[model samples]
Target: MATSVGDTLEDDVVAIPWTSFCDKAFNCLVKHKHDAAGSSLRIYASDFIRVYEEILDQDLLLERCKELNPDLEVTAAYLSEHLSQGITKALKQTCTAATQEACMKIVTCNAGLLVMQLHTMISGVPFLWEFRMPAQTASDAFYRHVTLPMIVMIVGLQKQQEDLFALLNDKDSEISDYKRSGQHLSRKHLETKVFDAGRFRRETLTPKHLKDCLSNVHLNPFGSEAGLMYRKMMEAYKDITTSAREPETRSPKNHSSSNIPVEVVKETRETTTAMDVTRLEEEPKPHKVKKAKKRMRL
Candidate 1:
């Protein structure tokens, strides 16, 4: 519901509808999908927030999922949780934890489907069939807010991260940007925006509007660790771009580069952590905080 001109979406931000997202996902998985006797979509999705808070078995998931919609076919079952908020899709029902390696495969193989899913989460009105995301904590909200835009900015060909948010995500930030003359954008001010955390499908945020909300990579966000997460994504892309352009160079090639396809290098949102960030030592301290706050954001 952001009405201010600053909140308007940039021309580069792509619009995605929920139905289009799911249909594309279904088409991509049609090869692997089959009708299961008792399979359901509602079980695991009954309430994502609660399910994520606890460990669950496949049978219980089937009962709940099937009860919600029997005909709904899942190419891959979301068998396990990744991090606190990451629920992964897989083919098996053994409740195996989705490995980062597998996520890496999805990134390489079905990036379009992945980006579509992100689009659904970012803008589609909160609906049931899509993964029912629950906002429970600052970290959850923070990841939701940043992850959507981050994907479009980096993985997308058409969409780019808005200038406003990009300024905050800049790997190199200066002290004077946050303050000019005697003005200071206080920690409280940053937290308000971080907590405002726009993850809902209907709400939109623009960079010009975010200038009042965002700060350089100096002062830490008080609530969510989105600041830390962005830096890691930027850093990881070095290897991602290198691998995409020439996967063979990074590892032994089973096929020629021409035969192998390059896909979006979007890292699994669940797999990214603060530990993955290696630039903390190089970043100059924010004058506002004696020491930088470092916590897992994604």
Candidate 2:
């Protein structure tokens, strides 16, 4: 950990704890959340480097480079291969050696940075690289890293919502056309209610609802069914993006009429017709009581 004092000098910097930094960032966000017309906060790339070096004290290995140039470049293939191998090795060692408490301490104290534990392989040779990260960030770092990205993400999601709403309306129009042409749906359960975006925003998009969901973060975000669901969603997204495309034609077995028994088909037809008739007959009819005739026993 690094410590610094506030002064109006060239090398003056104040390093706060990671927890305190986060708290201060959160309070700032909450204070300015409703300031919609206010100008957005300005951030620079140097802010990231400054916090990492002056606050976290992690070496980024820039000093080791010739002339301390930050614009050093490498081939993408080389970079990816070395990064993957290094991460695999690091994860194996960490999981095998580190305890749960030790892991938590690393996150809290060191700001989740693995100091000087990475190695890069080049031409069948390995070399140590001290690619460090900031343990303690600046007060506005959260806005740059988290809040700005979230605002952009919300804008994207709102666009997606509008697109979906338009699609639903088009679908409803097609369904209405079918109905106007005297075409009926085979099943009542297939009919969907009209989408109400206003209702959804009122009921689900409330600040209280969001606050309640965020309040449960302390109870282990990845140690519940929600974590499993998140993994499943990621798997689905991966499959859709990377898997091979499906065939255009349907399989013959799916539409084969020979698979159905005659008795079952007749029963289904009769049941559907009976249901339709009952549904059409909305008027209630009076029921007459039948008089019981006295039985003469022989």
Candidate 3:
């Protein structure tokens, strides 16, 4: 049985609710099922999982953190522990069959909190996952989809890494950025820092990029469950893009009488000048009205 919450630490440990976690995972799965999975992430849950897998150690995770953004203050132990707890929660809840309607049925409970004398380290985001009311849409999508999967991909972790590799070897960060963009893991590893909430913030993520990524995955000639979500997203993107471009293309073609070009107006003025000259020649002048006045003067 999982505890509803974990023990508070001297270091900041953000507590994610079991109901919330499952809801997020299920929504992610459904969204992917409607647009199938492209990725997975975890760790006692850290050491237990790490005991087997030969991926990078905490040093690499922390190294990546330091390389990408010096300002981000996260530690490998903190991240690993969080992953382990998440995995622990996921393992307990995910094993049993469940439905979207009954999503809140499972909750995550922390077994206990242990503070060691030697290796004690504190870590995690200060944001408190403090998403303001009506959280930004991009941040929400990122958390539900990209964030979780990307972490797994970055960490090279699966829900059950305990079985993937022998428990004795080591792991590195060389393959951290390989997320599944298509039939295989994507090689286009964009260098982004891990666990920076601002990085996952709405202003940073482009929905179109994610849409493109998701859409390309569905076109994987091989069968996969990336449903019409990608197609729909593309359709939506196409519709909006086409609609946006339409006005720009037609703008120059829109001509009205009031907006006649300068050349045309000049030509019309020249034609009027010729017609006035013709009318002057056709009109009779005051023939000899001055003759009588000139005779009287003589």
Q: What TM-score, computed on C-alpha atoms, does each candidate reach?
A: 0.19, 0.36, 0.16
RMSD list, candidates in order: 24.2, 31.2, 37.3
**TM-score leaderboard ranking:** 2, 1, 3
Candidate 1 local lDDT, 1-298, one digit each (tens) = 2121112121111111001001212322110111123222211111112111112235654453355435332222332122111222322111223332111112222311221111111011211222332323433322332333345335432223444455654522444444445666566455323212235212545566567657432222312255344444444433343444453544455322221113233222111211232111222221231221431111
Clashes of each: 7, 0, 12
Higher TM-score: candidate 1 or 3?
Answer: 1
Candidate 3 has a TM-score of 0.16
lDDT by candidate, in order shown: 0.27, 0.32, 0.26
Predict model 1's lDDT versus the native: 0.27
> Following a full C-alpha superposition, what root-mean-square deviation does model 3 have from the true structure?
37.3
**Per-residue accuracy of model 3 over 1-298 as CA lDDT, tens digit each:** 2111111110011111111123322221111000002111111111111111112355654564455434445445543343333333332343334321111222222222211111111222111110011212232322322232233232322322433333212222333423332334345365433433343345446776567556644223112222222232222322332333344555444422122223322222111000000000111121222223222110
Query: What lDDT does model 3 reach?
Result: 0.26
* TM-score for candidate 1: 0.19
Winner on lDDT between 1 and 2 is 2
